[model samples]
Target: MSVFDTACGQVRGSGPDRGVVAVLGIPYAEPPFGADRFRAPRPRSPWAGIRDCADFGPVPPQSAQLPGAPSWSPGDEDVLSLNVWTPAAADGAAPGGPLPVLVWIHGGAYTFGSGAQPDFDGAALARAGLVVVTLNYRLGFEGFGHVPADGADPCPPNRGLLDQIAALTWVRRNIAAFGGAPGNVTVAGQSSGAASVACLMAMDSARGLFRRAIAHSAVGPCYSPELAGHLMEKVAAEAAVPATSAGLAAASPQTLVKASDAVVDAYRQNPHSGRHHWDPVLYGPVADGVHLRADPLAVLAGGAASGIDLLVCHTTQEYWLLDAVGSSAKVTTEEHLNRFAADFGLPDSLTQGYRGLMPEAPVGDVHLALYGDLMFGEYSSRLADAHARAGGRTFLSRFARQRGGSEPVAYAWHCADVPFAFGNLGEESIRFLIGGAPTAADHHLSARMTAAWVGFAATGEPGWEPLGASGGPVRTWDAADTTRAPAPGHWSDSGTVRTLWRSFGYRPLRP
Candidate 1:
């Protein structure tokens, strides 16, 4: 049946093509606008009749016009909604009982992304025996910007995170009606979304909402309260607000987006600007000591998220995507490279070691490699290592799939593994991300990736060994050897690359 019952009303989805039905634009929380703007999410009011949920809800306010995804228009207020894609069940009940659920939070550096993106379609995942959910929450300044306290009005920090928790709560109470088991849920994301997963694991309010997590290329060094306040000051200055809760609320979302854009442009134009000049991302989860107890790695290593299975993965060259997209700054000479090292507080020895490793590479190439590892690769690896060391069951892997010759975006890089895992390589909008049309090997690789995700969500057996006391094997996804799973990825991270970053930790970045 295409119609299903929910807590507030009934919803009729649009499909059963190959056994999958998607109920889109279901409100998990009330609209976070008007009287509710900048506050924690509240329950949506009960409706009178069935809501026609045939399309995605209005997206959070963002400037990014992603491929095959709608950008936020000025007057869209009902932004806190979610979508579900379930296998067609027998009379509103799955034939083989409820399936494990996977809730996805899309990533665009915490500013712009939607669950309705073409790459995140859940039909393949539903066919793989999963009840898939994707959601939209507040973004940019509306979600992550810091606002001052205003007594009873309750302008809370990290409203985006609260929206996510509200969505999960809705799933817990209503997923069973859509052929999903409430207790068997996996929360997964990439980049900023992955970092949100790490944050959720440490939150007391999010406890018991899900049993597993998959973080791919989790970004790090969350904003400290002071840093968040500082960034908001810049945003307010540009928006002509007074940097107070009341003042911030007075400005419109579209205006704040333009202000935030101005701040990023200023950073881009100045080469001598601080750490943010390299990659001027202005919004992320704030470790305010109330919502987030501490950094996620610290919380996970301290055994906060007990009995949770964790799986982590990262692409070999994560920064290449940013460089190719012109989002990253250029460092062309040795002097510029040395200055880059000092700007992020990296030691000269690290650059020396990298030069020694890649003797023939130019300064620009070396900068990209080092920056990529510093921002994503090393952080993700360390998270997995820390979680495993704390006696948590963890699995780690690397995506080394790359295409040679002259495709600029051909590297096995950031965001490349998502389509493969979601089994949506054939989507027209996904061609640029995958470097033009797909190959037979790419399709085969996508199946293998989806199978791995399915296996992990089902039984916690991801076809490889769990991390042992010291280290564990990593499953490699490569196009070169789709014929057979290559040699088990050994605990090779503890060697040269990791040694250089051994003393490093996630500190609040400065501008």
Candidate 2:
């Protein structure tokens, strides 16, 4: 074991053969409880003594309520904690060291997830000569719920995003102590984490904190303020409580979580409502003239962050992991496809285009593919294309390896790249998804992926061509070998899909 005294407090971490690892759970900001609840994060009060960080900190007060998923007890008062894995003490290494830093943000649709998940262990990445850090942030109602018309605070909701910003700030201040280059940081996340990275890219607060970013399965849209406010109103109504600051302050954490769950259930049941789901609260990260000045996609289209290097991509069969109506075996018909498309606001011509391409495929496949393209594939390409057109360095990729022997054969499903990215392929969670243990091929792929990630953090070059450069290609990590080629037509077909996203107010800049 090793220990370090950081600015916020004392942190204890585990060490490996390479060097000492110091995990810091310093509170970058105050707990968003009591009067401060439902408002933007405020700076944490500096502590007097060494605060022990030997164990993982408590997660935010959230629904201890997963129906069938495993559950664990919550922790200490400070739910905002960060875990770090480094090769050695920063002072021990040379100034402006060559070692890169990879800061990971776990994804749970901005609702649930912790950095302590076993699959996120950073030992392997540290062994590969990079520092790895993960953190916990407020979630669910505590992190995203909006205040009433007569709320006490002026900042718009997106407290969770604010927490992320605080974590990055922490990284900037003290990563050097862990033998990391403070200026050479890469922020990466999956799903909502990816969306958060997109938010960071557009957030003025996050500017200059990290030099590069990697967004896996990044969402193309964010909640509009009007939509988010309406959802908050509905949540308040469902809880049979007033939408006032006092009423919310008086509400219990459990009540807020349950109410938010009810809202999600209602939205799922009535997909035609045209309302933002629980994940993207229409009020989340508004163009509030502050935190997020504009929509992420819009900012990218306007050449914002053109100087930040980006590595963005999505998994193949992105929606296969979702237990929604479209992924079911029973929904393998044209009727089902049309219904799903209607719910997703996809055009008939687009549906027909998918059918024409995969004529012999199952209706369920076509249905999933249509929505998948609309939700992930197209948007991912547009992000790469947009950044490239703006003269930023960008590389795109697709995870194509299918976890063998699973019933549905998850084909690079949602979040499938996480374990591989962290080189935790043999962990139990990863084994369950990949069916048994990861083969030798999986280990090789993990090494390549980790190296690419660390390399990008070090020099903003991800071992691939820029999306709009002369080569304009992608590096595909497959079972056979790591290779590069021009992005295939299927991956680069951005025209029609770009139009669809633009309808949602996203303008894609083409090369």
Candidate 3:
């Protein structure tokens, strides 16, 4: 066993090799239970002697949203812990070192997923010569549910975000013991986690915590105070309690979870009439003028992230995976497609534009394309555009390749690149997404992609040019081919999407 001292206390970790050393489940903050519940994250108290940190900690109580989404489990609220994977070396290396740190935040629409999941094991990236850290934060009602402070101890609105910031703060204080340079940190995540990264870049508290960021498929929006208040009341009603921290805090995690599920059920049953018609319940960061000062994308456009290098990417068929999770409806009739378009305040004529873009695709696939662009792809592209326009160094990528597919019309499904980026395609969580066994081509693509990510974390360059340069090239990655091209418009190559997003007040990502 190897032992290292951190600011909080000494921790015993597993033996190390030149390849990797792991120290798992070290608490970064105090348990958020009892009196601590519904409050901002507090520093974890120091321990005496060496504490064994070899096992993963319990994840936060999660609400069941989809089949694989995390759910309530029997555990205390001591979920704010982190796991670290670093290149093995002797103790007392230096005040600063050659290694760069990448802190990973997992995504589950901000409701499910844990940093300790097998899909996110950091050994591969650690073996490639970087320090990797993954952490868990409170989810659902315990994390983002806002109770009216109303002069009482204002229950912190963004406890989950506060937990993440606490973890990063821990890294900055103690990474040197693991041979990592606290000065060269990179924050990276996908989906909701990516949105968290975007939010962090705009946060004053997160300044100087990391020098670079990588956002993959970040589809997040700033929650307004009015929306958060309404959701809180809905959750409280389901729990049969008052809409305040003291009232809701007395409820068990399971009770809170059931309350959360009820709110979602109501939304799923009658979305337009649901209390939260525009926002997802008990998820996302709020623009409460406290933790987050403003809309994340607008802040980036205003140069809040100009000093931070950015690398953002997305899959070609992002919503295809949403279909895998039963999140999309099959468009069987022309009227169905028109209604779907109308829901976005878009012209029914936009359906023809989608069909024109993917002439060979079936109507259902086309519908998936439209939904994907609206929910995720467009946001990611526009974030890159905003960052680049603000003079931030930005590199955009399109993960357009996958295994086990013969037909090739944007087959790179959502969450597909994750395994490739981590160089762990054989993990069970990724098996369903990749279909059958992975091919030699898949392994090759994984290698190149992993190398690029590692390289980018080490330096600000990810083997691609900055966006909006000389034709605005976007580096496209596939198993058999990797090339660059002028911004490819939308994933579906539909002009309708561009116009629709513009109507929604988004500037174009493509030149």
TM-scores, all candidates, are 0.96, 0.89, 0.91
lDDT per residue, candidate 3, 1-511, as tens digits?
A: 7788898899887757555778998999999988888888899999999989888787898755333324447666678889998777524583345588899998887777888777688888988878899999988877887767667787887788889999999999998888788999999999988989999999998899999999998875667777777777888999999876678877888898888888876765664542233223456688888778877888998998899999999877888887766655556777767766765555555567677767877888888887777667888888888899889999888787855457643258888788889888787666777765677888888889889889999998888778863226677777655546534455354334565566464321110
lDDT of 2 at 46: 72
Kindly list the per-residue Cα lDDT of model 2 for residues 1-511, writing each as its tens digit: 6666567665666554455465645566787776677766777777776566666666776554332223334433477777888776443464466468888887776777777787887878887777889888878777776666473556447788888988899888877767787888999888778878888888877899988999988865666566556677787888888877777677777787778878776765654544233122322345554677776777776788987899987877777666341323334667766766665556777777776666777887776676666667767767777777877788988777776554444566777788888888877765655556778888888888888887787787767667774326666666854446543345223333344444443432110
lDDT of 2: 0.70
The candidate maximizing lDDT is 1
Error (Å) of candidate 1 at residue 392 is: 1.0
Off by over 4 Å in 3: 64-72, 94-96, 271-282, 347-352, 406-411, 469-471, 486-500, 506-511
Which regions of candidate 2 fall more than 4 Å away from where they truly are?
17-24, 64-77, 89-98, 149-151, 271-284, 324-332, 405-408, 469-471, 481-511
Off by over 4 Å in 1: 150-152, 405-409, 480-494
- If candidate 3 were superposed on the true structure by all CA atoms, what would the RMSD be? 3.7
Write model 1 residue lDDT over 48-147, tens digit each, in one string: 8778899999999988999899789999999999999998863277777889999998889889999999999999999899999999988999999888
Better of 1 and 2 by lDDT: 1
Q: TM-score of the candidate numbered 1?
A: 0.96
Worst 10 residues of 2 by lDDT: 275-284
Instruction: Score each candidate by Cα lDDT.
Output: 0.86, 0.70, 0.78
Q: Count the backbone clashes (under 3 Å) in each candidate.
A: 0, 4, 0
